[model samples]
Target: MDLVAINLIDGLFYGLLLFMLSAGLTLIFSMMGILNFAHASFYMLGAYFAYQISLYLGFWAGLLIAPPLVGVLGALIERYGLRRVHQFGHVPELVFTFGLAWLIEEVVKFIWGNNMMAYQEPEILKFALFHIGSNSIQAYKVFMIFTSMAIFIGLLFILTRTRIGLIIQAALSYPKTVEALGHNVPLIFMGVFGVGTALAGVAGVLAGPSLGTFPGMAVVLGSIVFVTIVIGGLGSLWGALIASLLIGWMTTAAASSSFQFATLLEFFGMTPPADLDESYLRDLWTLSLPQIGPILPYIFMILILVLRPYGLFGKRDA
Candidate 1:
């Protein structure tokens, strides 16, 4: 495979990882009507928690342990904190989460320190899986891909097949009606929120070694996850998936390519200024996927809002 194809695959995998973290976020915001800024903090927590667990047990065991612990934390917060704030209004609820985000980061820094932690992939999955031409595919990445796919499929099953899923769906559309129908809506909200945060935690556990366990990591990726939901359409799972993939591919492709601006200038028969800094253009020409990955989702979000206000798979009213 060419460099372009390899980069595209890399971005796609990264995007899927983002989707795992963001989809649960979309569900929480769309269903409960609260934007959780701390969602990415939970992802950070997952990474740290997994690191701790992996030290005692193993990487796989840490994966299993971290998410549930994060889920419990989320459930408690929702039951105690958010439920009380809901009596006020959406603004306070949002502010509370925003505060919670700051608190989580501070706590993380206190516990893990402000520096990036030393984390590594398991030895069994550390090597390259195969080589395609000049490109090599890592086993850890393949593991990440399959793990993400499993989570996606598992989520679909839970949200579509079970009785609780129906109730959750109903609550998203008509909370009052669901409450009136004699269901424990609050519990459902707590469960979903916990589940959602737990998913973010899982992403952290999987990504932490490669992404690093750091204090500012949550702040770095938090807004982009929100932007992913907005671009995908608020409360739409499929929309989030599509948006993630689109942003991932666009950023990766743009970063890997080196377009000749000089060719365009030559085509127009134009000349550069004698003292103009060619260094800046040289740096611009050499831009790579990782550098530009952060901004891609926001750009896609703007485009989606302008072009398709309802998003790709989002219902118009939703």
Candidate 2:
């Protein structure tokens, strides 16, 4: 029970991290209808940028500096690269981002090298808060959860209460109408895209130390983030929140479990052929969530697509 509780806590933290990355992607996609494949690459950039900034300014400062830097970069990409490709349609926009992802990874490798960069947690947040029964919970994880919740609330307020948020919300629902209302629709789109990418960068900064800072980090987490957005629903923030939490808990629970399908098979009087290697069956039976964390969201995404084509909360047509 303590173990389960620990796993749940850990998973909730993980989910918050995912939310940070996915929320921006969801906002951009929901508002602009463009799927930016380089979103995760921006996350990787954030970690790298934060690491660089932290060397001089400390972790908290890096958190502040890295996100805005990434946001500026995102804005540049949208204004110059994505905007140039916009005329060709969504495919070209996606392709541009895909290529951009490749370029960013190469650039990162060129500057940081192929080896993993050492990123340490800040001294202020390095302690464990307390123990649940026998399992200890780290203060850093608690910080992450609170930070994520804070971001979520801030974003909600921006979207629902602020004037710019109102315009963005209106544009999302009816872009043509918003444009007709004498608003600068294109600029709004660009700003939202930049903000969205900035959010991902912030997530990268926060998650960098634990997730590792490496050139391959983008490749490692890129698809899973996309799967999360898809599974949650493309344009729905609520869907993304629920999906992130669900995936986080599911992955953690799977990673912590000890039961194997082989044990169940034995209980049911079933056995693999004597000639066949039982190792394969054992591997299957012993599968755990953390081991398959990246793929789980994809599986869930497919299931969601089949059952709810629009998404768990998505209203847009496929």
Candidate 3:
């Protein structure tokens, strides 16, 4: 059905957005053991930075330049800030990044004002790319899908085939050993952190149009990114990808469904309350899937943690 098709496409787009953010977190928090609470801050920067750059350069230039700039900032943070805290263990690193997240938010509010900006898609991509029955799909959404796929493919090639990726992977397991082998492990960590944050930046740039560009945008997305990587499994690249898509589809499905708790109550052989407003559980019984769609991923995450502990594709429990 057209409805199913639309949901699938929408889910893929949402999933890819999550992937862009979660992919970086997996590399940083999962693979590299860096608790980067500020990762989504970089994502927020991307939208704001792109908005500023796009004012002078154009959307294409913003798309090209903003992420690298954000990446450089991330690398700088890793090199100067996070590296200094490394001696104190992950607790300090987490605390540092957590503080840094709030710091970035304050800086953004100072620079951009505490309001959402009009970060629209380019004129070229404003039209519909295709249609499903009566529904027209925006060209921008199609562009996002392809762009995310390209990034995923490029990243896969880099990690599996490239020399830098091999070195990075080696450093993930044995930083001291890699350093002993004459590789600059610290530089690798910086590079990984930079790239990871760059990916988040890309997501921010792409999502700003629909998600709204604001200082608090990062806060809205930050926890979801962690849930995604956790549900996917720590230290597992493929796990992140699977979990991102799964959550995306699940969310889209829930949002589009008409199902409510009342439906479930009937299946359980319970009579509907004659005066719903008077019932103590009126809200619970009347709640539709779409009403709780945003938190559905978290619910599923809790279930995964309770049932599987290690996630669908996790190698080991943390």
For residues 1-318, could you state the per-residue lDDT of candidate 1 as single tens digits? 478668877888888888988899999998888999899999999999999999989899999999999999999999999999999999999999999999999998888888888878998999989887778999998899889988888888878998878899999999999999999889999999999999999999998998778998898778888888888888988888887787777777766766555555556765654545654555434445457655766777788889988777778987
Lowest summed lDDT window (length 10), candidate 2 = 271-280
Give me the displacement of residue 92 in model 3, in angstroms.
1.2
lDDT of 3 by residue, 180-272 (tens): 999988888889899999999999899988789998899999999899988998877888899999999999999999998888888889888
Clashing pairs in 1: none
Candidate 2's C-alpha runs over 4 A off are: 267-269, 272-275, 278-293, 316-318
User: What does each candidate score in C-alpha RMSD?
Assistant: 2.5, 2.0, 1.2
lDDT winner among the candidates? 3
Counting clashing residue pairs in each candidate, in order, gives 0, 2, 0
TM-score, cand. 1 = 0.92
Ranking by lDDT: 3, 2, 1
Q: Which structure is stronger by TM-score: 1 or 3?
A: 3
Residue-level lDDT tens digits of model 2 in 1-318: 788789889989989999898999999998878888999999999999999999988999999899999999998888888888989899888888899999999999999999988887899889889999977788888988898999999999998899999999999989999999999998998898899899999999999998899999988888888888898889788888988999899878877776566666678887655644556565656554457655666788889889988888888674
Over the full model, what C-alpha lDDT does candidate 1 score relative to the true structure?
0.86
| Ranking of candidates on TM-score, top first | 3, 2, 1
In order, what lDDT does every prediction score?
A: 0.86, 0.87, 0.90
